[model samples]
Target: MSSITMVQAVNDALREEMRGDDDVVVLGEDVGINGGVFRCTADLIDEFGEERVIDTPLSESGIIGAAVGMALYGLKPVPEIQFSDFIWPAFDQITSEMAKMRYRSGGQFTCPMVVRTPYGGGIRGGHYHSQSPEAYFTHTPGLVVVIPSDPYDAKGLLKAAIRCEDPVIFLEPKRIYRAPKMDVPDDDDYVVEIGKAAVRREGTDFTITAYGAMVAVALEACEKAAEQGWSGEVVDLRTLLPLDEDAIIQSVTKTGRLVTLQEATKFCGFSSEISAIVAEKAIDVLEAPVKRVSGFDVPFPYTLEHVYMPHADRVLKAIEGVMTY
Candidate 1:
């Protein structure tokens, strides 16, 4: 029961986990002494000392590769890639090495590491700093993909990710780092289970599904629709991997229509997976075709960022279209 910013929530999670478990260590470029490029790791170096909280060279591969070694040696190392767009250089270490180590070694070696990176666009970071790379890791087996929309989930899920015995790609929507405010649980151990979605609003018209920064947009649209005599249920999908199909199916069953939104490109995005689930299992219950309101299927541009990310207007328009059908 304490209102805090998303950045502060993340800091709390890291601090709590590091104090709770001696095996937990943080590694990445400028994460220690410099406190990260985004300042998420601020004051951590002063609190945890250099051995447990480390700052390395500007190399993503080196960071991931070293985490793999550390994890195999019984240390839970969490690495932060300054931006999601810059994780490509470490894709091999993530997808090929960290992800499959436990499986290849027959549970003899577990890569319990968390790769955190800021994703999505709204701060005019263009393409290099705002790519949503969750879907990329979602496609890779043995990797857990997670995205939190608010302060509470950010703190809870980060603690859970640090404890889980797998490689987790924790995507933090940079836009909402300081945007949404909520009173997180005051309990010392308030870990939210990954893969569960939160219903932000309750309605029977349709379910607007979203995650990360887009969750706030969907909530805003739902509020506006309520003022206009329309009702819509808003779902905040906290995790991307090990998805809770039961919750999604239950929401769509009640609403009879579903609209999915994301900040990433539309083609083969996370929405595609959710839509396929509804089509495969709940087609008869759907009142209308499941629609996707997402970023255009093209490289994100600096000049057209507003056009690239889904906004409340697009979400409401999609809701209106679904209601008509």
Candidate 2:
């Protein structure tokens, strides 16, 4: 095991997969020569050469289109979208082509690919660079949405996504990409199962469900709640699609309260989905109304980002509200 940043672990996963599987190829703008805007794919070209590590033009649609073609031809292509805010240009290709190939083709062909993009707010990226768009993809069928909070889950889930037959949208939380370092497993074979939730802390007062960058914030809130004579259980939802419904139900059942956190807007967001699930399946066990601490229903701001995004204080407020109710 080694203590490494999330970005470095991402680089480790990509390199390990590329070395083990000849079909695994990476392509995106600045992914080859520049090693990606965040350097998640840094130094990959030196070991894999130009054929495998390709640098494409500045076109999100083109990059995803080419990846679909490569996947159909039996290559596992991992393409980066530079940022989640820029993925809209390739929305048609991703939802229409890459996502529907398996079912639309009667199971004869499959697009085994992974689209990696940095998402969420924290850095001073304003609106263009700090949008949490996982809900858009999660709403689509036949696509797996993954968001990792730490180096261990980031490396493991990424390796699993590359090997999976379906297309996976791997959203990297840029806020915690380098902030928190953990002892990540050095073994290349270590792969976290997709569609699973990791319980970060065990408590009985209430439950906090979060993913990506919000996991850390949720944990902080849980710790603060503990000081106020309340215990909160925290669950890190590693995958949005194929969500771990059983884990969620189990957590909410034990705590009798639920508070979900997300970087996206509250209306029609992923947090709403979790709230709905708890309402439908575990309503009898709920002690209070399911609460959600999320971003406002407005564009991410440059000056007011700290207020716009959900933080530990906001999450703690929600937890306190649910506990009191």
| Candidate number achieving the greatest lDDT relative to the actual structure | 2
Q: RMSD in angstroms, all models? A: 1.1, 0.6
lDDT of 1 by residue, 216-308 (tens): 899888887888788999888888887888889999999899999998888899899999999999999998898899998888789889888
Q: Once superposed on the true structure, which residue ranges of model 1 sit more than 4 Å away at CA? A: none
Tell me the spans in candidate 2 whose CA falls farther than 4 Å from its real position: none
* Steric collisions counted per model: 1, 0
Residue pairs with colliding backbones in model 2 are none
Candidate 2, residues 1-325, lDDT tens digits: the string is 9999999999999999999999999999999989988999999999999999999999999999999999999999999999999999999999999999999999998999999999999999999999999999999999999999999999999999999989999999999999789999989799999999999999999999999999989999988999999999999999999899999999999999999999898899999999998888889999999998999999999999999989898899999999999
Tell me the lDDT of model 2 at 20: 97
Model 1 TM-score, all chains together: 0.97
Residue 208 displacement in candidate 2 (angstroms): 0.5
Name the top TM-score candidate: 2
